[model samples]
Target: DARVTQTPRHKVTEMGQEVTMRCQPILGHNTVFWYRQTMMQGLELLAYFRNRAPLDDSGMPKDRFSAEMPDATLATLKIQPSEPRDSAVYFCASGTRGNTEAFFGQGTRLTVV
Candidate 1:
């Protein structure tokens, strides 16, 4: 059994700084998703990729945020000039089509001053 893996599980940054989070989705999972969790918004899907191709990213703020699957084993999410509002736990999940369960990473907790 394999599981999604995330790096830098906890992060603290100053406002206007840059932040990057990384994840490794489960092998054989074609669909990968990024999510942001907050008290107000709960869990919001930011972006997703299928077979290493980005399907949609409208949920993310294009001005400062970007998500990409650089290769089959690596996915990255970055935020430049990060703001306090951007502070939240970002999660990575992966699942294949026809699979009802989503495998999720431990989640990267980001804090911006």
Candidate 2:
């Protein structure tokens, strides 16, 4: 079945550690987004891409967070020197251009102690 798959469904790490999350978007979906959810911010869009090209990442902390789509099927988000404040559920979503609906992955729950 076509689906968005996210790895490392749950993670716990010390502050200052590096965290890497992976996502495999559904085949043929040309748009992708990286989002973080927390009680304070609700759902926030951290990054977005279309046709494998990065379109926006303004919501992400440029100093420590990054999002990239290295190929058509893979999208990655990395946080270096992760802090406790970064704890949240990260999600990857994909959709076709012009489609109003987006398919979301299960999400990776991260906790930095």
Candidate 3:
């Protein structure tokens, strides 16, 4: 009964708008990841947090993207001044240490015009 869930599965936005995406990770999972999938990126790891603390976010665009875990089951990624180049599928995944199987949400497909 536990699974990752994402909101606003599809979004259409104009350039320079603020976009918010939400994720609910599976229960009891300690690691959460944010990824962007596109023709150019091919499922790039954008950011991740372990035990509610961010481990790495080097793949995320610092100026426009931010990711955070406000609680055990919730994670969020926000983009400000979203550009056409940012249009892609954003996914959230969760897993435990040394666990290769990650549970992924359906993803939020953003189309920036």
Global CA lDDT computed for model 1: 0.94
**Between 1 and 2, whose lDDT is larger?**
2
For model 1, name the residue pairs that clash.
none
lDDT per residue as tens, model 3, 1-104: 88899998999999999999999998889999999999976999999899989999999989999998989878999999899999999999999878968899
Specify the highest-TM-score model's number. Answer: 2
Across residues 1-113, which tens digit of lDDT does each residue of candidate 2 receive?
88999998999999999999999999999999999999999999999999999999999999999888999999999999899999999999999999959899999999999
Sort by lDDT, best first: 2, 1, 3
Q: On lDDT, who's better, 1 or 3? A: 1
Q: Which candidate leads the pack in lDDT?
A: 2
For residues 1-113, could you state the per-residue lDDT of candidate 1 as single tens digits? 69999989999999999999999999889989999999999999999898999999999999999999999999999999899999999999999977857889999999999
Q: Ten residues in a row with the worst lDDT in model 2?
A: 94-103
lDDT score of residue 24 within candidate 1: 95
